[model samples]
Target: MLRIAVPFTTLLIFSNCGMPPAECEPNSRRCEGDLLIGCDDTGHEAVTDCTALGATCVPQLTRCIVATPMLQPDAGQTIDAGEATDAGAEDAGAPLEDAGLPDAGPAVIDAGTPDAGLVCTGAFPTNTTAPAMPPYAGTAYIDADAMQATDPSSFVDLTYAGRGVRTMFDRRTNSYNQVNALLFDARFGISKHVEIQVNPEFTQAVAEQHARFYAHAVGQLPAFLFRDLDTMWIHDGNDLFGGANRNILIHVQQGRYLAMYGWLEEVLLHEATHTSLDSYHLNMPRWQQAATADRVAISDYARDNPMREDVSETVPVWFFSRFRAQRLDASMLTTIENTVPNRLRYLDCLGFDDAILP
Candidate 1:
């Protein structure tokens, strides 16, 4: 019987070699002849036969480095698997540091202080509508007018009352507080199986406005991002958060942080990644490999919280560059390409079609 090898536990038997697999510390990689070997999170040997791919094994990196013909696809052309693989090799020369996580390697790249060219700034770019970088600005990438909810006026008559604890920012206290709050029965259905529950602290009018706006904005996003998201918790606080339990927490003040800022849709996308994409991709073997290969952090926030915030932080930027490139400026796009080429390519390779995207 022919057996297909799974990633993170691949066992490749070579007819010419009769050597036992060398044991190593978990998450550390090494080269064994033409084979790139690493210890997975479970301390099991994960082997990659580099010779088969016409690649060279490097002990410091996760992927076998290969030199392939680079293709420059026109703006209208779709990026193919071959392009993604070629792009991964662009930063192979950079040495990576293991951040002491199971599958995290910290990239030394800092956005604001790159060696040369346009330095990244906290100020939102004026040239395009790219979403504000998360944990940062609140500018809207997708215009408020663009994303009209399928049924903004749709309200489900389900009275859902529950006790929940979430981290909320208090403008008065000037800090985030873990508030044991009440989720009142008032709710609105924005999409199929999706509802937004507003806190009882706000008046009926305020709650309704908030619910309608949220429903319209969130409803426009690709459905796949909220697959596990059935309930959203809204309050009159000053921030937003995403929970592993498949929910998003919202605070009104985050949208009002600045007079020109407060693009909740952008923030919603960032938080949604935590709810939907983190579990599936966070510690996935391919994600780790891509991170190591890219060997650069998209932002300081991502670099600081490699395992926790990397996916959530990176996804908004990835989404903009891939699906909304027309809305982005040339310099900013160049920054993304220079900073996280491999990660961008990895996302491209995923081949998310209309089924997952809108």
Candidate 2:
């Protein structure tokens, strides 16, 4: 994670609030809470409470800037920002199973509970049985039409970058391809920001649409999921990939494959896990120890590529099973519980907070 460092200056302050005022040089600019504090034309300190006028203190600007979009990262960049919320029923376009209520097959693990220790006493499996389908192949955990927090009505500015030729990986061909891409900074929500560079082989209308759609979808997820995700390269094809320098490659030809299965959002969730979690947890000794203790894999894909794809594959399954169990069928839930209880336990022990998640 990157830290924003603002230089501090010492100065005598007039007694008003007991708290000391934020220090500043004659022409220095910095943000102090909701106030934009800096030197005025006379080289004296001036304070403006940006929030009082429905604005925010952005250090880059001389004055408070008002916009529905979240405040941009201080000094043109930051690692994390924003709040989390559910993608309510308003946007859910997928069919949901209403089995009255979730069946009590296996005890559900509370996501918020802190792990006491690594306690996998269950018997290690000697043989592995393959799951029927990929976790995203069956039911849609993240509703395809789920209500987006993205306010299209709000102003969106393409701050920088321009038309240029860029190399983007095409997942369908499993190779890097050269294409003219429209590159720019797209900042939305309260603080969700990412660089969207799309293949301009598609029309400008289509490019902007893809950018907004993906931005909206990604915005619906918790901010923590993509702490490392910095850029999205949108191309044309049928596959998506994440990881390697914190990027997600998206193929916009989303018709037969993604729509037929309704795995668009779920697929993004998988890739996000790669960008945000793979480096920290995937190859860790504790994770390897947990795998050894459990000796089970949730899917054939995870089993085949244990080191590369296991965490990414299992996380979505764990996410739906633990957080959205009501939307899942009993048998599927049972499969998750039986197949990878130890994996679930390992995830639980990580102490991830589903903050603001409903």
Candidate 3:
């Protein structure tokens, strides 16, 4: 009865692509008929909160950016990013179904690199949309032309490949502001397959330091594709490296969610490390092997309910924090030791220099 996610406690159904159930947000069944906002050209009231949050806080003025390329938004309905919310409102609709193909498992990428390489530099698209994105989100297409035009071998760069994820999940995961936006940006740069090849010698060194810190829990992170990291820096509208933007995904927390910044970074690194090492199992798709390898990586908070979720955020944060210019805290280190086991050595068997910094 929540968003398309259905909140099965652990499982998320993705088989159906039909319109989502218009009842309540996932994990909650409170009524919201009065909190709805926005309207279509045909005079039909539009729901600003498809996930049944509070209400649209901004004015819903429908405006299209990029004007649309392929598979345009519906003529009557506004752009997915156009809707805003108020405090209390709910427009009734049908029961929502699953969002995307559900378990596509990150292997749908077909286009390899083009003839001329280096064209991929400055090529990874910073802003774009997928074709089948929900009516509530932004355009979901990944600009492949920009990719081929820049670095052809950027194929290993899962940033664009993972672009489809935005269209898959129905709700936000805390990307409503700056810090959280950076978190999403950071995750977007890597993949669930492999996350160790983080270039920029300093970053890699930081990762190694974290790896050593959590050596007991076995932070066996996978190596990234190549030495040349095809990185996409999400530049907030501030100075070259500061400020924030709207490209961040909005994630809604359920209960007892860990929102600490340091832990979140460890999760990003660890999960991104999973994305990097994930490529090793190309022989078996959907990452059954990769997911199974966590026995070594799983520990501490990782052993908690859906500890995988916590590990995905906490491991990287703890790892990265250890190497921060500021002295890393001993409590955070213990948090890693107790909650997560070190698993970086497993990648060493894959011919990855997990011990060495990028």
lDDT (tens digit, per residue) of candidate 1 on 9-58: 12233222566545558655577787766554335454667677555675
Model 3 residue 54 CA deviation (Å) reads 24
Off by over 4 Å in 3: 1-168, 172-275, 278-301, 305-318, 321-326, 334-344, 347-358
Top-scoring candidate (lDDT): 2
The Cα local distance difference test for each model comes to: 0.47, 0.53, 0.23
Give the residue spans of candidate 1 off by over 4 A: 1-191, 258-262, 353-358
Clashing pairs in 1: none
Compared to the true structure, candidate 2 yields what TM-score?
Answer: 0.57
Worst 10 residues of 2 by lDDT: 1-10
**TM-score of each model, paired residue for residue:** 0.49, 0.57, 0.24
**What is the lDDT, from 0 to 100, of the residue 94 in candidate 2?**
19
Error in Å for residue 335 of model 1: 1.7
lDDT of 3 by residue, 1-358 (tens): 1011111111112222365433332222122442323222223222333233222222231111222122221111111333222222111111122111102233122122122211211112211221122121111111111111111121222221212111211122312222211111122113422222211213433434322222211122223322222222221111111001111111112110111101222222333433332223312222223323333223222323232232233323333322221333344333333322222111111222222222
What candidate 2 gets wrong by more than 4 Å, as runs, is 1-161, 177-179, 239-243, 355-358
Report the candidate with higher TM-score, 1 versus 3: 1
